[model samples]
Target: MSNQWQPHAAELAEGLSLIELSDGLGHLDLGDSEDVMVMGVCDDSRHAMPGYAMLCLPRSEGKATQFAESAKEQGAIAIISVGVSVDTDLPHLHLESIAEAGLLLRRMFKTEQASTHFYGITGTDGKTSVAWMLREALARYQSAPIWSSGTLGWMRSSNNICDIGNTTPSLLTMHAMLNAACQEGVHAVVSEISSHGIAQGRIAGLNFKTAIWTNMGHDHLQDHGGYEPYLATKAGFISDCAAHGGSVVANADHADIRERAPESTNWYGHGLDRDDVNLGWEQELPGLLRLSCAGEEVVIEDIPIGDFHAENVACVALTLMVSMGIELQALPELLTGITAPPGRMQDVAAGYGQVFIDYAHTPEALERCLKAARKLVRNRLIVVFGCGGERDREKRPQMGGIAAEFADAVWITSDNPRGELPAVIASEIEAGMAQPYRVELHLQLDREQAIAEAVEVLAEGDILVIAGKGHEAYMEVCGRRMPWSDAEVAERYLHRKHPGSGFDGERLCA
Candidate 1:
């Protein structure tokens, strides 16, 4: 949870033998000196210390041997890896698969026995929004503090936020977070579960009290091997919750999800009957939201902007009604306090022109965001976005095409580009568009400069949307993470352009 870590496990105070450490999770035999005792467990070589059992994780890059060497030199008592020992000096243990280690990790951290309720939201979209909404609604309903972990990292409340390192962190890292959350008096936890996390068994022994599957679309196609695998991965988590006697809530609008969900799964979406959970907006944005549950409806005057928000609200409402024993009629008061997770269609002051920041990298999410943003303005719509490197390359062109189709002006720039050339990524995105000369299109690799130019060209009533890195504060280039923020950068330019006018999102300094 914290940036700095001193990895230690108190269960091994007197030290546990290597055989006992492995249990059924590890497979390695050292006939002699098999009783070597390990005081703690750590996977990071830099954090390894005397009497610690180190885990050798697979990496896309870097030498694995060097990591083991560093840990051994630091006095690691043994090494647990995905496969058989890899020429290591320390006593070694291996697993049949990476997921098997989840059991070992759960026992090591003791989170499997914790009473804190876990709620998971998985899918290509709406995970972050749904998780935060659940957290906010639960915090208002419960007496204990609520903690959530997702794209924006871990945060117990508005004033308390910490880095979680990933959308779904590693098994070890997640255990550490849950352990910390339990220690901090948190009785409920809401988190986003990614496909990679599910495939890798990050949620191993943590039985979710309820899980929601938002709609899914084109995303991480390569990582999951294809559409079916990706769907299966996401559905696998939902099914896991259902199989474990936990509640399951799915978006009925998504046919794939509706068809795949368990028979007992509770559904909520656009056009359901009054008997089921549903949402109806009497008016557009800044209008009344009619949330119906079991033929009962509540009218909320102020609502979050976006068509998807209705579904998100309905999903949360259904979860509370079915799983948490809160009546649908009581939701009107608690629902008012629900807040949107930051960086999703967030509005900021831009003087004459309005600027919105959203983390819409996929085609569907981007289109939805642009449509919502377009409704907010009377003039031209300008957009700035770029695809992340080393990810699903197929979505890059689709995103570019979506931007061209929706925006009057498009600024193509760099986003992350972990190991790929920024220019190459931009060119691929540009390839999706036709008849736009390289010069005719505004292509800028420097993200800040791209945002500056986009902000400068904003007209009196035009709305500028900086998509793909919403609340993200860092840009990963090569192997390093550099400081960056879409909203902060846009705000600075807006402030500079109109020094006298308060340029905060609300247009008021306070």
Candidate 2:
């Protein structure tokens, strides 16, 4: 493999020579005066490699300095910790905050900043879809490569994508990806910024040229303490982008986002048939979504998708035209062949009505997916979904209630019950259903069996939706992530039912 992604120590310590990061008088022993070269930065000692700089952060468990010995044994050359001292041969640098130091370290190690326009999309539901659509739209108007980083990973191109393990990666990893993109002559980078990313300083120190707020919902409530803090965290991205002389494109359909939008910079809003929005969409036909932006109309045909997708498309168009300078007239042609991100309403197979696999884990997202699936199904709509373990437990009941309200038949199953009992998680979800004892509500602990049963019971005109683990390839149970795929399971069952029919997976149309 190429070493182009690695950042040298001298490059990483560019502005650290005379900087005073904290108010302390250098109380602790700052290690021996040996010059060190760092090949990488690691937060976790388990992932520490030779010549890496270990960033010791304070966690709920303990101080990160507790793992310094392990990282040193793994060949860490230097240590940067907050409020802790490690006695080792490695050089130690103390800072009041490890997150701040990490952000600064990112700035130092990153290659010459790319002129590439950076757009950040943050919200509860449509971050991935809007970012993916922005990447697709940018690819059509520019010759330089467009990079996208989010749940789908660091996408160098549509065909070449790699996972970085988070919706927004660590500050160091984010800079590394951006540096690599700049080195490869990428023109723009669009990333899905999450609330956790914003609150945790994962996206700190980077300047976004434009920020898009898709829509905020009641997800991640546990992480942010409540809905107010969650919304505030999402708003921080918009504030930072505007402070950097950038603009914001907001979803006017969301009242909270519209109210909290920044007044300092130019704000462009988009929504569904709203008079105040800069871009508005009206569904002219069953499968066609017509958008009117700046008196120019673009007709999206044959994609009898959800209103959420049309809203996502409208957000993309407004962001490109208002923030990125793409002409409004070019939207229709550019958006013609664009498809949703992998598993975001991804139609993996057809034949018996259709089967859609989406990453709709939140109550709002699940409701949207089922409502969209309802429009496409001529008969009954069956949904298979489950809440993730150790996440926002409050959303479990809400998701279950949405499934109960929307789908004709609801299948509650396991979804990455990491370190938590699958049955316990399913019970929590079942608690939200108004009619938990209804005959149509099927509770299956085994996700694969649940999917198979769902497929088996689907009528000819029925639609089957497997929600909650869209593009994820692993199912985490009892802290171990085993290999699993919702789309693959659905396909296998569909093929077993219709043997030798040459049922190649194809996009279903209305």
Candidate 3:
């Protein structure tokens, strides 16, 4: 039996013709004929199979022509490129741009236009939280399955979750996932749209029914070259949503988002202090989050403990209000059961002091996580964190400064030092702090040892926060991925330090 998967014959028959695909290409020569059937389309030539149409896009890795020979060897029936000719028997279709061809291919494969309502959430911090919350809320009311794709992974319904590597997968993979969801009768699809994904045209062809904007911050500066470009890339999603006759839920607290938000569409703003917003949240005592919208208020008692979570909840509430049209009065009861996503402010019992594992790599994220930790710590707050190599290096010193300002003690360690030396990365982070820092600092190159030291020094009523590499199952070191988990390592160290602490590797709810 062949290991290759094939698409439905009916779908192939209904696929767009070459003439229709090249309709927008001005006077470009589509060699031979335009009557050939496109059974499948792909950008990666390595994944090409018989009857597949390969897209030769010029990427940073190499030119698309570099892989055209391999694609032909694998039995590609057609090649789409921008005036690049390959010595193969396959039909060559020329276009002005490769991205245009990708968008056309995405439209061809996306057959779930009618059954699914797409919601796109884009921002620096709360994309995953908002997407997960929306999925959970919609699942309660809708009969069909709810699919969420983002940092955590692609999830079908509540129990089925799988990773697709990138937060936003390639257009080809996205269309395949959407088609599968359509086959499974999905009613809603929520996705976290990253700036890189938007700028790189990963989500080019899909139209969303609702678009959400979390707060903007300093992130992906290296990829975007600057903050303004990154903000523009995210803002473009809202414009696309508006163009499709969809509504937008924007964060009123962010001036950039408020300014870029579509004024003509059904725009709903959300924030803690903005009176113009449709939804807002105010923190209350005894672990209650009071949510208000349109003269109606709902107080949720089972609120997750975190300052950042309040803002995330407000975003989720606003998104749900716009997407599902659920009454604010009913949200209090519906929201009490929702939980935070894994590796995001996840708490574990460590004798008397609590241990938190979070994927907070950015300076702002670290500051917010420590602030939330400060509120919960009874005695002291100790943080163990590190900056990743080959990322935004400018944030290294900033993170170190935030750690010094917030944490009682800091342990700077390696965080996926992909190509750089671990000690060098640690030193860069240390450079951000004041001379003889206000708090005690420990530099450990080995992450596991750093975690062990933090756990061993934990006193009763103190809190230990393990930041960065939250839900990741492996650590990248020198181009190789090794099995590692911050939560598991922390738990093992905690058990070793205090035997019979009843730490069963389970997260403790706040």
Candidate 4:
């Protein structure tokens, strides 16, 4: 067995023949035999398989054991774990970081096939909405395009969708997806860029033509360690776009984004009035918006409800104009017929009034949702919302304060309270309320029942805003996902009460 290593690559055994191999023990390399194929690389060894190379990273003993067990079933060729072992007869090499192996693979395959336009969007909120909306709009005018990596992660130009867990996939998967899209003659690729993805170098070496900056707020503090780190990660996306002389559309309304604007002729500012340039929503209506930009008015009617959605549409619209060269005058006509993204201020027809299911988990997003719900109705605005467990707990009570201020009736219910007591999370949120109001402290822990109860109590001319799990089709609890949908539950209850009404917003049961 021959042992050779590369310092720069941080990979073990450059080219060696595996004379002997074991699923539990490492590999023994002969002087020849360079045809070993690696099936997949994972940090957890439990997923390791037989007939494949298993690279177990140091400080990941659990992963190494997992790999050893799973590899036995899959018929793995060799197991490469962290640190050095001299007692074993198997050939072994040391590695500094397992992530380095993934990078090495991409470097060896460094070559471009075709010119692809990539649009990357990053922010605390609006990342998914902007990415999805841009892809949908671009399809109407351009040729068949392929977009991957966001909520669902992988969606082809053919609209074949699959679940890839990360907001930004691994470097290997991302490049592979991009390569596939290029081979299919895809015109563009739209993606949601997360802060963790940027910091971890997941998007390294990828060529992006356009980038959009949404407002930055307090979220993901645990991952980034602080607000400054979070902001820096987001700024990196714009910097990458600027390096290629690509257009970067920034939110002028966000002071942080405006302050961190990069130097590029393609850079365009979209905001409300500043230094003789004002770009934003002219008049925002319920599910409609009059978007004005660059002295042109594009009234986008029947859009997703929410005050902040108007701003999101503005960013997407301006991005189209600056990056794809879509005409501004033709935008209103184009966007007027667009459909709202799922779970984002989605209006569910109830028997008594309209019910809105939104993914407004943050304080700012909740505030915008409440304010928008207030305008769309004649009588009162009722909100049913709760914070998720094991997340940013500080925002719990703050959201409670917003509910107290904006909502006519507030129902604090469990929202994916994973591994945490529902009562504890509700108590934290209740601490922030300033005024006395009709608050239903339901520790039901069942989201469907909460929505059903809220719908049953709604009167005429009232709106029930179900905030938290917007487009998600399932509820996650105790590391397990359960089938659940707020919209489905509300619609089902509404239909049973009002026969033949059939999903209309105006029909009332009582």
Cα RMSD for candidates in order:
3.7, 4.1, 3.6, 7.4
TM-score for candidate 4, residues paired by index = 0.81
lDDT of 3: 0.76
Clashes of each: 1, 0, 0, 16
Please give, for residues 439-493, the per-residue lDDT of candidate 4 as tens digits.
5444445667777777777787888899998877777788888987777777877
Q: Which wins on TM-score, candidate 1 or candidate 4?
A: 1
Task: Using TM-score as the measure, name the better of candidate 2 and candidate 4.
Answer: 2
Ranking by lDDT: 1, 3, 2, 4
Give the Cα error of residue 503 in candidate 3, in Å: 3.1
The deviation in Å at residue 291 for candidate 4 is: 3.9
Which model, 2 or 4, shows the larger lDDT? 2
In order, the Cα lDDT scores of the candidates are 0.77, 0.75, 0.76, 0.67
- Model 4, CA-based lDDT: 0.67
In model 4, the worst 10-residue window by lDDT is 1-10
Clashes of 4: 16
State candidate 2's TM-score.
0.88
Question: In model 3, which range of ten residues has the least summed lDDT?
Answer: 1-10
With a 3 Å backbone cut-off (N, CA, C), the pairs that clash in candidate 3 are none
For model 2, which pairs clash?
none
Q: Estimate each model's TM-score.
A: 0.88, 0.88, 0.90, 0.81
